[model samples]
Structure formats: C-alpha cells, structure tokens
Target: MSTDDADHPLTRAELRARRAAEEAAAGVEAAAPEDSEPAEPSEAAAPRASTAADAPEAPQVPAVPTADEPVTRSAAPEQVFDDTPGPRRTPNAGSGTSASTADAAPAQAEAEFPDVAPAPAAAAATRVHQEDPPLVPDDAHVEEPPADPQLAPPTDPRLEPPEWQPHPTPAPVARRRRFPLVLGAVIGALVLVVAAFGVITLLQGPRVSSVKIDAQSAIDASGTRMIITASQPLAKVDPKQVSVSPKAPFTVDTSGRNLGIRFTVPLDDDTTYTVTVKDATGTDKQRQSTLQATFQTPKSTIFLLQRNADGDDTIFLTDLGGKNAVPVVQHEKIDDFRATADHLVVATEKGGTSVLLVMDRKGKNQRELKLPGPGFLSNLQVSERGNLVGYTFTDKGISATSGRASILVSQSLTGDGEPQIVTVGDKMPSIAQWAFVPDSSSALFIDFSGALYVEDRSDAKAKPTALGAAQTVEGISRGTYTAIVSRGNDLVELNLADGSEKPLAASTPDFGVPGTIAPFPGGTLRQVATRDATGLPTGQIVTRVDDDGKATKLFSVTGSDAIMQACPSPSGQYSAIVVAPKLVNNPYDQSLLPLPTTMQTHIVDTKTGKELVVLAGFDPSWCAQAPHR
Candidate 1:
C-alpha cells in the first residue's frame, strides 16, 4: 500500500526452472523452453510506484485451492491448479514469448498490486504443486536378504525397524585336556595302597624279642626253666633246632607264643647253661628267627638243727656238699625249726607253753611271734615261697590228740595279719599232719583218721573239702595237683585234681617199705624204702622214680640203722636222710624215730648213689627252695 512495501519481480528463467522440477515429480519428462523472443513487460508486471499521499488500502486475499479443485487466475491474484490437466498454455510465437515468460508475467503482476500482498494461501498451494517425489539413481542397487533355514515372513515396512541387523553366533571355546589329571589321581591312590600294605606285612611278621630265666646265679636246682617270648604267635618248634650247651634233655611248651624250656634233670651247681633255638617260626610258618638264652646255676646249701645234750640246740647252715657248716641260731629247747631265704623261724618250748621266735639268717634281731593263745606248738613248718609259717597248736590244758586240742594255723612272716587258724565247720579240726601246699596260701592237711583235706588259709572262714582216705600223704607236688601216697606195699601218685590214682613206685624185697616220698621240681620222685629182715625192717633204701615208673636206687643202707625220713634238696641234686638204729621194731610197722640219743643225718646224691657227708644231727631241713639243697 505504501512506496516502501514494493518487492522485486520474478524473472522468466526462474519460473521455468520451477516448472521443470514439478514435472519431474509427476513422472513426466520436463521439456527445455524454446528461446524465441522476450515479451514487453506489461504495466501490471512492473513493480508499482506509490506516494505516501496517494497510497491505497490493501485488498483481501482469496482462500487457497484444495487438491480436489482446479485453480484459475481471477485476473487479480496468483492462481492454483490441481493434478488434472486443464488448458495447456503454449508459447505465443508472434509475441515471441516462451511458456516460462508467460508464467512469470502473472507472478510479477502479483508484486505490483499495491493494495494486495502476496497471500500465504496462494504460496502454500504453489509449493504443493511443485513438490516432487524422491529420486532413485539408475546405478544404485538394493541387496537381497540371505536365506535362513528357519525363515520368518516379511513384516510390514511401517511396523519394522529401519536399522535392524542379524545377530552373530559366538565361536565355541577349546576343551581342556583331562588325561594328566586323571592319571595323577590314580597313581596317588595306588601309592597309598602300597604303603598301607607294607605296614600291615611288617606287623604280621614273627620275631623273638628276649628270654627270661629264674635266677642269675643258683638257678632252680631241681629243673631250671628258660622262657622265650616271641613277637608274634608261635608254632611247634623242631626239637633238632633246640640245644643246650651242657647237653641236657629238655621239654618245650609249644602251645603258645611263649616257649618254655624245662630241663628234665637238675643242673650242676655253679655251672652255666647256654640254650639256643634256631629257625623259630610263626604259627603260619610265614616268619622265622633264632633265639638264645644263658643261665647260671649257683651252688646250693642247707640248714640243719643239731641238739646238744647239755647245751642249747644249734642251727647250722651248710652247703649241699656238706661243707662249711656255720651256726646261724641257738635256742635252749627247739622242738622244730625252719629256715627261709632271709630269716629263721624256731619253735622253742619253755615250761608248758611253746613260743615261736623269728630271727635274721645270721640269728640277729630276734623277735617273739605272738601266739593265738598260751599253748603248746608243734609241727612248725615254714613255706619257702610264701614266707608263711604254719604250726599245730594246742590251747592251754588241751591234750594233743584230744580232737579239740591242736589246730592247724598259719601266720605270715613278712606280712602283717593275725594268726589264721585252719578251721573246718567253724572249729579247728584235729590235724595230725599238715603242710603248706607249695607256692600257695592253701594247706594240705590229714586229720587223725588219715582223711586228707585241702583248706585255703587265706580266708579264716573257708570250709575244708574232704580229699578221701589215704594211708599217708608222703608229699604233694608243688603244682598241688599230684600227691605221692603210701598204700600198703605200693607208693601211688594221686591226682588231687580228679582224685585218680596211678602207681609211681613200690617197695621190693630188697627195699622193705616206702616211708617218705618227696617230689622234685621236674616231677621226679624220691623215697626212702626200708628193707625188712626177720619180720622187722631194719635196712633202708633211697630210690628215685619218674612218671614212667623208671626207678633209680640212690642210696641203700642195710643193718639196724634205718632211714627215718628222706628230704629232697631244693635243687633235687641231693637228699638229706635221717639214719638211726631202730630202737623199737614191729617188722610190719617199724618205728624210724631217732632214739634221741644216737641219730645221724646223711647227705647223699640223688643223681648218683654216692653219700656226700654224715653229720651228727637228727632233723635235716634244707635252706634252699626247701629247708636245704
């Protein structure tokens, strides 16, 4: 409307280029404009000049045309057209105007209209008409999708993502080798198994460790035994493999791992014995070894009690060879006395009551033994192994044979305890003969009726069991199982365990009656068999017998002199026999008691029939395992 509102006019070349671009979008080839002549600019085509005083008001613009309608120039503003072809505008040749120049002429008139500004509605319509579709290059090619085994149908282009891609599969990882690890584990297990097996095998092998003997010196004289212990269970050993240096016959205990070697005969005193066992094997014979033991036997000795007519009775310690007699003790009136390894026990009588005295082996430190009552004591016997002293005592005023008189009682010399009375049925029985069962607290006693019994003196209230009737119990084995008894003219061994009887030895015409029998450590037995002449036995014979009934005559004396008692030495190598002339003789039952005036004791060898010594003593008590050796 004002002079300042005027804008620049469009050129014919610019309008032609815009028409080509529109033609390309409709899939039509745009033709180049023919260059003929230029047309004169119409008055309406020129930009109008206006003065501020003569300026006119602007005119209202027409509404834009939609795609459904065709557009036509109103002769006053720009027109819009639809897709449908209407009238074609050919270039006028006479006017020499091109189609592009004709189109620009109208656009220039729209700028010159002073009262009308270019409408926004017409501009938008022209842009839509000139818009072109996207171009595709002739050389550009689209790649086809690869084939998939399990293919999915194509999705709608509007729903599918623009930048979608296929996922890649990961490569497989390499596997690790396991051969070395498995082999190592197996080898480790085998090593453990082999180690365990070797340990077990070593434990199963047999070995001999050590040997044991009774004593370093003065080994048991009777039959010294050697104990051999093995590390494992043992089998029966070959006799040829066992030997002793002194060349003595021996028996072996093959029932256990511990081997027991027992020499059958007495070993020489003060001698060394070497034993060897080769090829000692286990019970399964899987292992073998050798064993050896050395033992020495000391010289044996004995103690004897000698009575003087006008003085006191003296106790003498002498060797088994009957040499080196030394006075150990002296008492005014000794009825019976016994010696032990360390002390001497004596039964001395004063007035009517009997007293027991204990003193060291040298006769020092004399102490009086407490009596149960003021009574007369007899049959005083000392147990060499148990250190116990046993005696028969009569209560004051009670007669010796009265049934209620003497009772068998025992007391320990080293142990402290009241005197234990050997009682039966709550009362002491009339024990005529009683002795300590060797190496035990029990006693083997014979009543006045000659009925034998065994009572355990450890319990004062223990009852006595009857062991049947016997003529006389010579001696019981240290094992307490076998007893040598006198039955008429035969000396039989009674098995105290089962009450069975077996003949051991008998008196022959040369030997009258078997008086006292003594058992050695190795089951050998020796007895004094008296020979009778003129219906009264006066001669005596000392014979040794074995379990097989083999007899050996050790000593034989023929005359008025008789063998009162035969005491075997502790080593069983010697015998102390009381020899005296028979004062009163009743042939069948001769009294062998010494006349008290003239009695002698003879020490004789049990192996040989040689007499060692004769001493002026009646009762001979060994001081070795017994009272003497």
Candidate 2:
C-alpha cells in the first residue's frame, strides 16, 4: 500500500467512479490534437468596457436563464447543460438548472489568454479547448479517496529470482567419467583371471611329465650337478632299471644329490663334459624303474682319492674317465700317509710295516725306516718345505679297548729318538675327526664324546687339552688347512691357525643353491642311502653341526627304484649307487619280478659333485686315485 492511499479511505464503488471520470476527461484532451488551431479569443472575460465598473471576472449563472434570455451552445458539448444533452445529461440543480461553459467561460478566457506565457517546461504539449461536459455536484459523482492501495503493495523487482543463464551448449560430462570406468573394468577382469588360474593350479597335483634339459652342453663352466628329482611319490618306481649316460664322457655321481655338491666348479672356466642316462633300468629281479638326467661335468679331476670306511685303508685312486685303478697299499691299515720329496711316512697297524717308506715319486715300494708305534694309524702331516712329518695313532702295546691313545712325531725315522708318546688322558679317545695344528707341533682331535682337544707336543707329558664340546670331528686331508666341524644344527668352522670355531650351515640358507656345508639347508633333503627309524628305506646326510648343536638337512635318499646298496667308490669320484627309477615288475602280473631292471655302477664327480659314468657294479673300490683324464 502507498502512503498516500493509506491516509485516505473510500468505498470501492465510489473510488471506481472517480477513476472512470479521470479517464474520460483525459480521453477528451487526447482527441483534440488532430483538430486544433491557434485561436485569437474575443474575451468574454474583458473587464467591463469601462474601467470604472468593478470587473466581473466570472458571473454565476441562472440555471433557467432569465425568461427573456436565449441559451447559447457553440461548439461545446450539449451534455454540459441539463436542459440540452445528447447522450449524457448533467444533474439538475433545481428545475432545469445546470452548469455550463457560460458560467466557466470567464475563468477559461483569462486562463487561456495567459498574460504571462507559460515557460516551455510547464506548457502542455497539445492545447485543447474542448469543454468538459462539466459535472454537477450530485450523489453519483461525489466520491471518497480510495482505501486499498495500502493493503496490497507493488511487486519489488529486487527480490525476484535471478534470470536463467543459458550456455551455448551442454557440458561435456559423459567423457570425463568414461576413461576411469573402462580402466577399472579391465583391471577387474585381469584380477579375476589370475584368481581362477591359481585355483585351477592348486586342484591339479605337481605337473611334471616330459623332462628335458634346458641347458646346452657348451658354454656353462662352473660345472653343474646333474640330479634326477622326483615330482611325485617314487614308492612305485625301481631305481635299478635306471642307467645314466653322458653324450660327452665325464664323471657323474649320486653323492652330489645326497651330499650337497660344491659350487666352485665353473663350466666355462673348467673343462667341459656332459653325462646322460642310458638304458635307465635296474637289474634286480624284484624291481625295475628308470630315471634319467644329463648335466655338464665342468671340472676334470686329476686324481680321485678316497679312504675306505674301515680304519686301516689308505687312499684309493679312481679315474674320473671311468677307467680302472690299482691298489697302492696291501699289507697294514694306513690311516694316514703323505708323499715327501724323498720318502713317505705311513701310519701302519703293525710294527713289521715301515713307519716311513722312502719311495720314488712314482710311489714305487722303496726302503723302509722304523720309528713309532705299530698301532692303528689315523692322520699324517708334512712340513711346508717337506722337512717335518707329524702323524697320530692309537698308542701301541695297549689294548684297543684301553683308554690310552698316543701320538708320535719324528725329525727323521732313521735318526733314533724317543717316540713322543703324548698320551691323551685316562679316557679312551674315540676317533671321529682329526687335524694337525698348523704352524705348531700339536694335533686337534674331536672325540665321539663331542669334546674338542688339542694335543700339545711342546712338553712330552702334556695331555690333550679340551677346546670345548664339538658337534662333529672330521678327519683331515693333505693340504686341507682347517677342520670343518658341526655342533648341532650349526657347523663349527675350526680355524687351523688358532683353535677357534666359526659356525656355518652345510647348505645355502635359501635352499635354492646347493653347497657342501655342515648343518645343511632343509628341502627335499638327500641323505646317504640307508634305513629310517622304522627300518624303512632311508639315507644318511653329512650335515655339519653348529656349536649351538642343531642339525640342518642337506639331502635325502631318493632313488627311481628300490636301491639294493650304495657304497663310496674307490676314488670318491662316484659312489657304488644301485637303484631303479622305473619298476617293471607289476604286482598285477608278477613273474619273478619281471627280470630285474638293469643296474649299473656310476662314477660320481666329487668336484662338481655329480656322477661320471653309470655302469654295472663289477668295479671295486681298490682302484688308483689319479687316473689320467
């Protein structure tokens, strides 16, 4: 509502009448523009012709003009007078009385004359003299000011909602989200495929069928050990039927599989050789099976040396080329012996045997010289320049059951001197392993009681002092500087320089790489073929013991066929391993075990730690050590 309307109230019907009247009066003025001329007025408003009379500006008129007067209607609407109207009539004042131009003429003439002309800003754009059919004062025309412009207010543009802004085109919304959705779907499918494949693989057992060698015979040097491994349970197969062959002649062995093979034999650097299985079957009538493999024999051994498990045997030499060997010693059990520049001292079991034999370089039987005890021989040592000889043996004139074990040292066997009978102790020393102390006149020995003792030769009466409880006592070899011992699960690396022990594993800890170590790495453990606790087929593993006393698995017994027996070969190049990978005797149709699968003797290479040849077991361990390759 406007302030002006709020101040004045009027009935709705009366206000509408007033609005109509205003519109009608405006219409009369708007219609005059088409028919207007500048009028030179003869003034009815002129003062009486003489100035003496008081000017009559506008005289009130009689509605019924004086009886003698006539009505004048000139170019004015007749509706202005009540007595004379065409369509509309003004209200009568009394009888026939009306208001007209005559009454308003004097005022109109003065206003129109305009003694002082109107300024341009205030003047009307179109002048109209058309008389308004003047309205008479009556109940119909009388009205009060309107009351309702107050209650309803005009709409305020400031509060309206903002106009919608139209872009030239819709936004590129779909492509923005498309790439990630596609990428996510592709990734999801890949993951599902991988998951399904894993499930399928698990459902099927170990998938091994056609075994082929991926390695070529040429190039690879650090010689590799050829091993035939089983993917499934081998209780159904026979090892005797299996025969190994090499395309190129080289040493092969199962010892590398049972005993962790050495890793230093480089195929490229060492001489090249290859071995494969031929007629891989066993000869035992009870069983028949065959398993075959071929690998490089990278390094060639100049001499393959080994001592029999029996205490009396000296070194047996075998040629890695699968040739025959000859026995070097026949009479006494020589536990230890060394070749000297002029002579060789041998620890022999009987006094008739020479304590030292002066042999030619060819190892021909030469002159004998006497010195120490005629007891079981153990280890032998020579000086760096070949001037001194150190050897150990069980004390003589004492019962083998007696606890007294003795060691002797001599500058020269012929030069008579008291044999340094360095008695160990009242306790009988059981030999497990032994080594000559480097740069000193003493020997380190590990007894079966797990005690490490050093026999000092400085004082003739000095007993062997205990280093500590050792896991294993290993026998020493020529040019082997230190003793590799094992405690329990760990290997005690005995430093020859100082009587110290460093623990190490017999195999690589990762179990991915094979190594000759003490407490070995456990996997498909290969042990020396033997019997298990249940009296079932088993094998022995030469695991080095740690000072902490732990056993790690190195290898386990695995034969393609039931193995009859396995013995270390003459040269240690190969062990007399008899087995079968394929078993021909079917229990469903058994006929004398289907004529035993072919069994063969295989020469094992100790360097690369593999077999050199696989043949029948007609060979003996008495062969020579160094056979020309």
Candidate 3:
C-alpha cells in the first residue's frame, strides 16, 4: 500500500474489491485438487459495477458464532472476514462504485469463501476506520444511505423508551395521589365491619330498641297498651312469662317486633312500674333474653259534684291534694254527673224536666245530649271503652199506664243518635237499678220484678240473658266478668259471663256484713255499719276487702258525721267516702237524687288507711253511678 493510502486509509470500495478478489481466489484453489488445473474466475466472482437490487447473491455458509459468543482467530498474515454485516462505506472519487454496491461486496465475499475465519485484529481496525472522519468536505451535502433490506426495520417511535429524568415527585403530590386509594380501603373495611355486626345482632335474641307508653291513659283507665319495640322480630310471648312490678293485672300480646302489654285495670297514679318478660327470643329462637321496660304513671285527679239549693250547683275537678280544685261544670241544679276519660256528663233539672249536658274535661264546649223523651234522668253512668252513657229515665207526667217510668236507656256520649231503650221479651220493662259492666257496652240491670238480666247494648240482635232473681247489682268487678249482687239475705258474686253464682265471702277480721259493696280491681270497698252492744247503728266504717279475704279499715265517720257512700278509685289505691257532717243539722236538697246540703268527700288511701285529703263535695267521679238510697 502507498504511504497516502496507509495514512488516509483506502476507500471502503477499494478495500471491499480487494477482499472479494482474494476470497474468490482462495475458493477456487480449495475446490481444485493438487493434480487438477486451476479453475477460471466466473462472472459472479469477478469485480463489476452493481446496484443494490443487482447485487450478487450470498452463498450458503457454515454456522457462525453469534454476537454474544466469544470468537477466536489465528494470527496469520492473510486477510480476515466476518459474516456480520457492517456499516456501508462511501466510495472515493477515484472509485467508480456507489455506496450500495460497496455494501453488497462483503455479503458476496462471505458467500464465495464460506471456510474463511474472522480475525480480531482486522475487525478492530475496521471499527476504528469507521469511526474516523469522512473523506468528504464539511461544506458538501451528502445523501443518506438507503436502508438495507436484510436488516430488521427500525423500531416504532411510539414503542421507544421515554426520556429519563432524576426529578423526584413532590411529597404533597405523592400523598394526594395515594389518598383516594387509602380512603377507599378504609371505608370498605368499615362498611364490612358494620355489616358483620348488624348480622350478628339480628341472629341473637330480641333487644328492646324503644318503648312507648301513654302515662295519662295508664293512670286514667283500664286496657291501656304499652308497646315495646325490639331490634328484630320476636317469638310469641305467653302471659305466664310476664310479671309487672307493683302487681297490676295485665295481658300480653306479641306481633312482629312489638310487644304489647295491656293493663286489664288502671294502674296506680304517680308510680313507676317495671314490666319484664322472661325467656324472650327472636323469631329464629337461636338465643334467649329478657325483655323489660319501665314507665312512670302520671298523678291522678278526680271530679266531684257539689249541689247547692240556694245557688248554681258546681262540678269540681281536683287532684288528691284538694288544693287545686277547679270548677268544671256549673248549673242551676245538677242532680247527677259522671266523668269519662275526656268528657263529663252532667244531669241538670230545668223547669220540671231533666237535661243532659256533655262537656269536655275543662267544661268549655258544652253540648246538650238527646234524651229518650221529656223525662227526669237518674243513675247517670259512663262506659269509657264503649264511649257510652247510660241513665234511668222517668217521664215528667207519669200515670199508671201512660208514661215511661224508670226505664233503662243508653246513648252515645257524642249525642249522635236517640237513646236506646233496654228491653226484655220485646217490652221496655221498668228498671229499678242498673249499672254498666266495666270496659264493655253490656249492662247489668235489676228490673222492678227483682230479676237481674245482662244485655249487650252493642248488639241489637242479642237477647237479654236472665240471671234469675237478684235484689240489687251492687257493683261489677273490672275485667273479672263478675258482679256483686245482694240476693235475698246474702250477698253473692254472680258471674255475668256464664250465669254462675258464688256467695260473696265476707271480709276477714270480720267487718260484719257490709251495708253497701263497691267492687273494683284487686278488691272491693265496703261501707260497714258499726253497731253497739244493743244492736243499734252507732257509726260507719269504710273497709277494703282484698281478693284473698284480707280486710283493711280505710276510713270511719263517728258521732254526727255520717258516711253516705264508700267508693273505690279505679286502681283501688284510694277510697272516696261521701260523708255528711252534723247529720241532724244538714238538710236535704230538693233535687231528684238529693243528698245533705253540707256533704264532704274524704279521700283515703286503701292500703294504709291514711286519709289523703278532704273536700266539700259528694258523688265523686270514681263511683260508676250515683249512690242508690
């Protein structure tokens, strides 16, 4: 090689031509034997002008080492060849070949001399020459070489790796990105936990979630319902499993998740009652728990009537303390009055006839009720459950066969319809005394013929049930379906439901046979006459007789003060004793059901016989009807 060629390196075209010629000669020598003549060069082996499309095809070659495998070669003076394609070399001005034709030379040489081994030194020298400066000037514009079809296509721009940077994300930005994920995880966990707890609670026994009780209703009347709502639906509850503190009679009914406890009788006023149901369970019966509720009843108040012959008679509503007495109703002459849960029924005499006035508890809205005819009303009584008021009526002008005399009649408190005449065998018989059965529309009446009959006023088709002969129906026990009646010489308890008769037992500690018996829940209130050794009436004693024949002395009137009537409070907690102070001096009023003008009502506790209060009134609202003389 010349010095200029050695310094500047021969152009790639000249190098490739020289390498191809040497490989073609070596191939021809290897194909000929020692005794054979040298083979002539073929057109394919000789160097010629070629384009990329007209380049000679590559010969079949033996396996070569891959890019990753280590290659070894001998240190021989001969030229080295590589099977790997290299970068295309630009042709010099003296060479008549293009860059494409120069690129095809190496492939052609490798095909002709398939046994040629690669040299490390030559490969290093070729790489060094490739990195050197181009033979062309910097000012000249050179064309980019065309892509070789044998090589893989360039990688897609979209698939290229993104630009790298050393910037770390800001702390706040990283936290903001992760906040939603963390919150979602926590909220999901909380929801799952709450759902699990709710399922567990439902699988267990019923627990009382809430309770509702009408305190006013509980203290004022019987059959008041207290509802206990549970967390889940409950199983049936039996009455035997229920117990009430302070010992009030009650019936149990369970529906769905609500447990209803209906007090069969009124509860004591201003008292706290605890009701417990034992072995309460859920509908599945998987577990058992006790369901209990506590409620406080409100204080009770009562109404009393004061008849004044000189002025307007007044009906006063007062608490047991007798300090706060409010006049509720006033009329010229009030013969009898009865009070219900929300209303008052007052019987007043106008001219010579009776007028019935129904008013609210405050006596603001007064309305006249329709009567059977122009008659005198007596024995006014009210049934709170049936919303009815009953009375005995007698026509003002009454002859032997012309007018209605002491006939029993009942009507609605709203005065919507005419009074219904009570009948036996299609005839309106004269009733001597009648009383409403507690909590029902049925009436227990003693006709003038001395026959006791129970008739259901709610059903017009139902006939009266005759209960044989009875002197008088003293009183009926609430919820017991039993009535205390005076039969001949003995007092008997008549079962109004089944017509069964049993002698009324005398009070223990023997108060002697009572003159008047007033039946209430839990017991009866009796006004017994105290007699001297001479067998003469000396004084009056009001006694409480319990269900088990236990007797307690509640009140007494001695000397001149006389106890006209003894009545029990709704729950038997208190007794109202109507007394006339200075009996000889107290004159009788001119009303139909007249009492002494100077009458006083004494409120006494039945259990302890302690007198609560005394007020100037008679015929307390606690009594079902006016006292019969």
lDDT of 3 by residue, 1-629 (tens): 22132234443323333333333333321111112122222222224222222224333332121111111111122222333355433223332211222223234334544445333333332232222211222222233233554431122223221221113447788899999999999999999999997988876678889999889988777889999999889899999989999898888899999999999898999999999989999888888999889999989899988887778999988999988999888888889988888898889888888999998999988999988888898888988988999988999889987999999998889888778998888799999888889988899899999998898887768788888998877889987889999889989988888888888886789988788889888788888889999999888998888889999888887888888888888888888888889989988888878778888888888889988888988899988877665
Residue range 457-537, candidate 2, lDDT tens digits: 545567777777776543332223355665665545566556666654434333222223211111111223355578775
Number of the predicted model whose TM-score against the real structure is largest: 3
* Steric clashes per prediction: 10, 104, 0
In order, what is each prediction's RMSD in angstroms?
A: 28.4, 30.2, 15.7
Candidate 3 versus truth, CA RMSD in Å, comes to 15.7
Model 1 lDDT tens row, 346-460: 7777775788889887889988888888887776787755678888777876644553476788898864778887766666677877777665566778887778888777665
User: What is the model-wide C-alpha lDDT for candidate 3?
Assistant: 0.73
Q: Give lDDT: candidate 2, residue 502.
A: 65
As a whole number from 0 to 100, the lDDT of residue 239 in candidate 2 is: 34
Assess each prediction's global lDDT (C-alpha) against the native. 0.58, 0.36, 0.73
Clashing pairs in 1: 218-298, 221-571, 512-530, 512-531, 532-537, 536-587, 622-627, 622-628, 623-627, 623-628
* lDDT: worst 10-residue window of model 3: 66-75
Taking all chains together, the TM-score of candidate 2 against the true structure is 0.33
Quick one: best lDDT, which candidate? 3
Q: Sort all candidates by TM-score, best to worst.
A: 3, 1, 2
